[model samples]
Target: MECIKCKKEIPDESVFCMYCGKKQAPAVHGVKKRGNGQGTVYKMPSGTWAAEITLGYYMQDGKRKRKKSRKYGFRTKKEAVEYIATLKQSPKKEKFITMFQLWELFQTKKETLSKSKRTAYNIAWKKIHAEIEYRQIDELTVPELQAITDKYGTSYYTKRDIKNLLSHLYQIAIRDDYTDKNRAQFIQLPELQSQEREVMTKQEIELLWNDYQKEPSAITAQMLTMLYTGIRPGELLTIKVENINLDEQYMIGGIKTTKGKNRKIIIPDKIKPLLSWLMETGKKGLIAYYPSDVEFYDAWKQKRSQLNIRDVITPYCCRHTYITRLTTLKVSPAMLQELAGHEDYDTTLEYTHLSIAERLQEVNRLD
Candidate 1:
């Protein structure tokens, strides 16, 4: 069979057009939809990659020129490839909108949120706006935007937040004739997250500990702190030297939520060597002292690959490992909540992904 939009040959069993991404006409049944036109992924004049698809031709000065519709602002070749593939599968809207215009409409249409939520939404969009300002709604894909944090090397939690924001925007986009479906739903987070690496093996723990010893760098310090304390790396970066209470044997900083703020956690003896090394360095700012977010992530990914553990775990997974260890020690839920700086008890439950042995042991105590 041939795909109607691209005139490309397709297998008899194919459900969607490979070159165009539009749904195929069913042999007997199962045709969901078809793409409006075939799109080509190419380099834009801005030196960025884009998918150039016709938005329908327009006549000007008695001459008809193809009205080009494009999606822009991808940061890498791999992203551009995957993105244009998705655009081919979905049909573009007849009435088009630029991402900048859509963002404005979103701001006006959004209902009120809590102060913290409002602040969070504002902060997230600042990054989103920078990337999407020049692009069009036609080009954005859920997987591409979900990886936005990873592309820029921001935290996984921030990636989750970005995914949420994109999902919300796609909803509005679908409603306003910006696109056909919410691509955000199809996006899987980074490997460690999507795989749900909730706990680290003792071998993995030992590797992380030894790896930090070898480098004794700021990024390693943050990693060790998170492994021992269950603090998010983003929160760990905000901690100043003054927050280190050596006399009290704890640190005081965590700013994600109301309860998380000023959350003092006792420094584990295991992580103190890292803290001591950081203190000796005479650095006056963030402990994880990369010049920018990109460098921080770059350093981490490089080190992870060097450690030969990059495939299975990530720095954020250390926070989950900490929670799992505490749960093994039979830490009470309320105290765990306070120690973990979680605002809601329910949020704490997500971290309590316990093991079979742990569950069996706890259950046997009753008998």
Candidate 2:
């Protein structure tokens, strides 16, 4: 048998066009034809019934393109018929919207989100937007979304954020009749691992110091600042020229929890000169003008490669190094918590990566 719409050949016993998902009518059964645009219903090979209706039409490539709505798995043809009747009573408006288009619409309606949350969602969007931005939401498949989820291999937080943002977008798509389901909701993220946090080695720190003294550019200055101040990469971007008080040897910057936000970060004498140089050469605006943490991370990655550093040190590792150094210096736990902008001392301890030798020395201190 040939499909009635796409004219594709199929099994003779087929009650629906497998190619087009259109309901098929047998000539012998002589299914009664409804009005011009009333749609159709028929029993399927699975003994269930399916119904489909033409919601609207548009011109594409100089041809009239029809938009359709389909419902399947009805127990009986009468059930399918009733479903179509209800759809005719109040037709659902189909939107030929792309993911990016839906994202724009979603943002306009999401006015209550905090600045941090809004930034998070925007960053997540930037990560995977290029993959499916222009594709129509309805055409997206679960495997496609899962592939995107799997691409970011241990970036558990980023994967979660992307999944969260995509889920929200899919919700909006469903509400607007752009798509029937949220494929993102079905995508799974990698299990979170509790790997030991890494810190910059003494050699890497010396290398950075040497490089800064030799040819100090914006990148080296940024790294030195984070290493000394223990400010998060996200917080590092929030620093402004106005926030620095060089004479007072402190700056105000942070983000995330209340304890972390806009906290006073004391600038070490070692890093003060670098900050002064950066502020002098930097524009009269933000200290580091890379818009997002992702871009800053890219700069960090390139700088590491150029410096020929083999260790997988990250900007956050700089913070860990700072905390470890402070702990080694016997800085009081209260002061350490304050400087790290950690809500609790335990959290501050988590960021401190003491080496085995250092731990042994601490143990020997009991003697």
TM-scores for every candidate against the unseen true structure: 0.50, 0.68
For candidate 2, the 10 contiguous residues with the lowest summed lDDT are 56-65
Error of 1 at 112 (Å): 19
lDDT of 1: 0.69
Which stretches of model 2 miss by more than 4 angstroms? 1-92, 95-100, 107-144, 151-155, 174-183
| Model 1: per-residue Cα lDDT over 249-341, one tens digit each | 798887768998888877987777778777667355656665445565677787777767646566678878888788788789888888888
Evaluated at residue 39, the lDDT of candidate 2 is 82
RMSD of 1: 19.4
Strongest candidate by lDDT: 2
Compose the digit string of candidate 2's lDDT tens values, residues 103-126: 888887567775456777887887
